[model samples]
Target: MAISIFGLLEVMLLFINAVAILNEERFLAKIGWGRQAANPYEQESVKARIVNLITAVSTLMRIPLIGLNIIVILYLVVLG
Candidate 1:
């Protein structure tokens, strides 16, 4: 149960971090993901891709976690 809670927290952190990265240029640059481009369009393109990747990974991790939580809840309710 503790581990499951920890996993949920980790997933939540990932989502929060991803949002921060998307919203803050300085934060993204601090992590070296904010790239310098010759044009504004190119810079936006790279930034969007990086943000999308982070969002995808976090969402993918979350799906399995949600399933695990549902399974655990069902088990507890049905068994006890």
Candidate 2:
């Protein structure tokens, strides 16, 4: 089955983001932050800060991809 260009682009964007998150998690684990916690608020705060940074950058990255997806879907709908 052939995937639409927009669909392929969307998959690629998601794949890249997943890889980045995996890498970030690995790096955090390497630095002793194995995962989220609840005991120490400071640890949770650090994780939250990292999450906020990732979310900010991901939002910027997603804006263009989302715009592209919308444009492509609209084009397909209009042409079809």
lDDT of each: 0.57, 0.59
Off by over 4 Å in 1: 1-57
Give the C-alpha lDDT of model 1: 0.57
Q: Estimate each model's TM-score.
A: 0.29, 0.32
Clashes of each: 0, 0
Candidate 1, residue 58: CA error in Å?
Answer: 3.2
Tens digits of per-residue lDDT, candidate 1, 1-80, equal 36677567657755655553363355655665544422456645766677556556555655665676576568668975
List all candidate RMSDs to the true structure: 7.9, 8.9
- lDDT (10s digit) by residue, model 2, range 1-80: 88888678768766656634544455655765443422355644766666556555555656566666577678769986
